[model samples]
Target: MDLYAPFVRHVVAPLHALYEGNPIYSILRELEQTQWLSPEELRRRQWEKLERMVRHAGDRCPFYRERFAAAGLDPARFTLEDFQRLPALTKADIRKETPRLQAEGMQDVRIRQGRTGGSTSVPLEFVVDERSAQRKGACALRHNAWAGWHPGDKVAMVWGATDVDSTFKLRMRNLILDRRFALDTLRLDEAMMHDFARRMRSEQPRVVYGHSHSTYILACFMKKHGYAAPTVKTVVSTSTVLADVERAEIENMFQCKVFDRYGCEEVSLISSECDRHEGMHINLDHLFVEFLQNGRPVGPGECGEIHLTDLTNVAMPFLRYKVEDAGTPTAHVCSCGRGMPMMEKVQGRVADFIVTPDGRVIFGVSILDNFTAKFMGLERVQIIQDVIDHLIVKIVRGEGFDEKVVRGFQDRIPEFFGKEMRYDLEFVDEIPREISGKYRFTISKIPNPFQEAAGRAIGRTPPA
Candidate 1:
């Protein structure tokens, strides 16, 4: 067999990373040893990195320097406990003091500017050092291995595809290195799925990865159309929360395990599922993650907001930054025996909570659960609240969808979101992606008063 793709990856990819000041191989080597370390050893390393990172942020980052002084935190000699005593970083702080938070100097070095997909109408922009970039690359390769993909496996990305004029260099890069193709989730219509399946069947890809919802829809489409990705060994989902229904359907259709990963644009990969599939293992070497409710760490099995510290990114230290998602942490260790920590699951992003005109908020998941159970013909669903008094429900109707089901959905909306709002039921061919390529289940135009991202006041629940 011609192993040209694998051979080039094995030899040249590292060289490219090194030239760009990203030590991919070096990180890989370190991870190989660190993954086997004990949990105690892992945390020890995390504290060491945290100490260094916090000190660097305090000394160099203008925003942190002020906060550190106000909190009376001596970063130079702070212990792990001392670090926790410092105030948590919020999206508002990042927004109000972005320049101060950016690491100083090194205009000659690679400082990448990144933005979160503006699911909230306001996206946070941040910079990263080359060191953090390489560390993330290393973490990704290691995580992929857990999902049964080696360096050479042909990986397919089932994500947003660009327009008709994708550049030659980008196409060649995908052809040569990725051995991968994209399935424009931007429009997963009948024509798109047919064309995509044709290409995928030809490629016989080993791994197919995409936004969790997009991947689930693809699996359902393939099953309905009598197509099979027989060579596909594993399916990986990311960017969006994979609902229970989506997960079960994807695994059932693919006839393989689905490895779901959760992270964000700001800090890179947080956690990913291994073959064990019990829970996702946190990237301990790269991040210090905490799940908190009401500003304190929640007990095991309780859902809380995700607070993260990018241990490797000194250029912009995100110390205790709230990722604005809720998830449960586990005391139970993985059977796979990785030293990294584990989280039971990542709940949806804060934006996934839909708000009504009357200030009552509902999780898009609540809609999915009720609607999917009540209505039988949805391939995929997106709920958009673009105006205060109105909602546009986008549905990618499948086998059994009809006018009867449309009326059923309308009737059900009032049960969850009270009858104080207007809504439009738009049955579309497909659910498009955000500009940043991630898919969101719920999009709200109305703003949340107290905590915009959380979509609820400090003491309020969904409307009574």
Candidate 2:
């Protein structure tokens, strides 16, 4: 057992929170209790927060005030229905009205500027006030607890180069308080994995945390080289989509439960899996989440684009902000008994959807997770759709790759896509990671169905 975990959780964390003048530890305590509230009660509390944030935005944020007036809508008496009718906020809007989006009377508050990783598109620069930052931090701590992690417990992190803090001050803090060591996925190779494995043997961290694909890759490398996998308490997969195959392999190698997490840079900790692992529970305390098909609300189990309203970010309000991601809402309650609602899983980024020649928009994640990863001889594969009628497949072959494997793969493509579609298979040494150090399983260049639906919803004609 981690004997020091209790001291870090109880004493050191609270002291650090006091030194920073933040209420993160206090907020975490509230979260700990609220998770067990009834679903209806949780929704009621969520609505109250939403109502307060909306009113504050209308009164103080110039962008929202003008927008509310332009739409002939009053935020003071805005109903859920009226909120749905309001135009969705886009990344373009934030870029155009950064200054005006900030709530007034924040001169005394500390603000921090941040940006998206831009793995799929251009990077988006935005700001979050100190209060919102604290709330996000607390929410993350609550999720970490679900994975049985505590601040003082040693952690092995596999993440992007930009995410790791290597400053001398942070290094000292890591040694004493945070207790984390990171492997930069940007420069990951067999050598780096070996070094990480050796460190795991020495440090013996209780938890393994990392981007989904990066963690899976590390596990594969360890298995291939006959490295003895450490017995960790739990693994947390974040940043990218965690496929079923990837999760199973990581769990098998680590000898631990994998807690899949979903979030974005703009809004931290959107949702995370509890111990039940049935589905990810949305963070209702900080966000008002909506699922839309086109511009309208979608029912449970139906695929829809996810829009988020930051109920906590009074510094820069993001109302009905379209995140360009798709997911399905669940009507079933998790056995974990958390009142927070569940989302089945993220489908994929809107841009990652492959539009077939027959006008079918299939989720890219489903293709890779359900079909591609099951192929025995294929170590990794990426699909690129530059034209409606064709696909370019990049394959990283494993030991048993042969003509039979090629024929078998060709046989399955027409089943998902129509017989009218054609594809070219390019055998590769390896699939390259994006500049953000995240891997993309599929990239479609064609205009997706969601774009057309969004254009129609906003009363604008989509590009021909």
Native-vs-model 2 lDDT?
Answer: 0.81
Tens-place lDDT digits, model 1, residues 417-452 = 878877888878877755544566677766653235
Which one is best on TM-score? Answer: 2
lDDT of each: 0.75, 0.81
TM-score of every model?
Answer: 0.85, 0.94
lDDT of 1: 0.75
TM-score of 1: 0.85
* Candidate 2 deviant stretches above 4 angstroms: 162-165, 450-464
For model 1, state the Cα shift of residue 58 in Å.
1.7
Candidate number achieving the greatest lDDT relative to the actual structure: 2
Q: Which residue window of length 10 is worst by lDDT in model 2?
A: 455-464
